[model samples]
Target: MNIDQAISARHSTREYTTQAVDEEVIVRLIGAATLAPSAMNLQPWRFTVIRDQALLDRISREAKACLLETLAPGAQSERFHALLDDEHFQIFYHAPVLILISAEAPGQSVVEDCALAAQNLMLSACAEGLGTCWIGFAQRYLNTPQGKQALNLPQTWVPVAPIIVGHPKTEPAPVAHQAPQIRWIG
Candidate 1:
């Protein structure tokens, strides 16, 4: 698929089938991620792919508990609270693979670079007829020391994006998006 088609086809896939993604396809997606533009050639991104179901389940539970503990009681917390109330909610949606895009440095640009890499990876997955979703809910817990130990992440690597990839169970409908408000300046 072309870039345009990939971009249009890529969406946040929350549900996936039990089918496993090929290792070669996973490698290709990561290769695409590495090609993303970085600031000053500082390719600070590192990836950790998780395929173990037990680990994924533990991470999901810990992440939800961590989020609940940290959230303040207010309007913003209500949505999260409601989500946590669901007993069967899996943060990664039981995807066959979970890829964490991390950065070695702590800075705004480093974070941006990792995010760019994640976008590239997602698009590549779409082109390969796979589904991908960026799970922000996993971020907070994944950054913690215990979480880092669980994933065997390096001390310097900071988790920036949690993405799940697999074969989609169903195709999502087109999302209605508003046109960007642009101001021309010459």
Candidate 2:
């Protein structure tokens, strides 16, 4: 698919099939991600790919607990709390691949750079007929000591995006979009 097609088709896919993604495809996606521009040529992004079912489940459970413990009592947090209470809920959705994107530097710009890379990866995956979803719930746990040890990430690295990649069980219908609110000053 073309870039425009890929961009248009790309959406967060939660459910996935048991089929595994090819290593070559994963490599290509990462390659595309690395091509994203960074601030002052500082490519601070690092990626950790997780395919182990047990590890993913552990992360899901720990992340749920962490969110519950840390999030302040508010209506905004209720949805996540409910999801966590569901025993069938898996944060990674049991996808075949879980890619954690992290930044080596502690800066807002570094996080944005890593996010750009993630966008590239997702779009690339879409073009390759793969599904990807950025799992925000995994971020908190992934930054913890145990999470770092689980992924073998360094202390310097901070998790930016936790994305699950796999073959979608079904083609999802397009979601409606709102028009951009533009204010041009010329």
Candidate 3:
């Protein structure tokens, strides 16, 4: 698929099949990620792929706990509170793979640079007939000391995106989007 087609097709995939993505396909996607523009061409992002279901489950549990602790009472609302409190709510949505886009070192625009890479990765996945979702709920926990230890990553590596990828159970229907509110000054 072309870039425009991929852009339109890509959405946050929540349900996935049991099949895992091939290593070569993942490598190709990461290649696309590396090609993303960076500040001063400093590609400070690092790729960490996790395929372990047990690990993902543990991370989901811990992350939910962390988020629950940090959120002010009534900040998350009742519905969200129930969801986060549910033990069966997998934050990664049981996807077979998680490609973590992390920053190996600090930079003036490392987070922004990594985010661009993440977008590239997700779009590439869409082109490859795979579904992906950036799991924001997994990001904060993966940056914690315990989370770093679980991944055997240094404290300095900041986890920016917790993107899960896998074969989607069924193609997701497109959701309505609002037009951009533009204000041009020229």
Candidate 4:
């Protein structure tokens, strides 16, 4: 698919099939991600690919608990608390693959740079007829000591985006987007 098609088709996919994504496809997508521009040419992104179901489940449970324990009591947090509290809430949605775009070193715009790469990866996955969803819930646990150890990531490397990849059971219908409000100053 073309870039425009990919962008139009790309949507956050939560439900996925048991089918596994091929390693070559994963690598190709990551390659696409790496082509993204970075601030000051730092290219401060590292990658960690995880395919272990048991580990993903464990991380999901731990992260949910962490979010709950530290979540401030408020109406805004209620929805999150309810969702995380659900026993069936698997953070990665049991996708066949989880790819983390992390910081290679601490610096400004590192997260932003990694985020750009993630967008590229997701869009590329869409073009390839694969599915990807960035799992924000997994980030908290992934930054923890146990989470770091589980991934064999170094102490300094920071996990930026936890994206799951798999075959989608069904393509999601397009959702309406609010039109952008433009203010031009010439």
lDDT: worst 10-residue window of model 4: 138-147
Candidate 4 deviates by what RMSD? 1.0
Candidate 1 segments exceeding 4 Å error = none
Per-candidate local distance difference test: 0.91, 0.90, 0.92, 0.92
Candidate 1 local lDDT, residue 140 = 90
Please report, as a residue range, the 10-residue window in candidate 2 with the lowest summed lDDT: 72-81
At residue 127, candidate 4 shows an lDDT of 92
Candidate 3 lDDT by residue in tens digits, 45-141: 9999999999989889999998877766674556667889998899999999999999997778999999999999999999999999999888778
RMSD of each: 1.2, 1.1, 1.1, 1.0
- Expressed as tens digits, the lDDT of each residue in 1-186 for candidate 2 is 898899899999988999999899999999999999999879989888889999899888888888889987778778777888888999899999998889985886988899999999999999999899999988888889888887888988999989899999999778999999999999
TM-score of each: 0.96, 0.96, 0.96, 0.97
**In what order do the candidates fall by lDDT, top score first?**
4, 3, 1, 2
Error of 1 at 161 (Å): 0.9
lDDT of 4 by residue, 34-139 (tens): 9999999889999999999998888888899988988899997999999999999898999999999999878899999999999999999999999899998888
lDDT of 1 by residue, 88-143 (tens): 99899999999999998687698899999999999999999999999989999999
* Model 2 ranges off by over 4 Å: none
C-alpha displacement of 134 in model 2, angstroms? 0.4
Q: Which residue pairs collide in model 2, if any? A: none
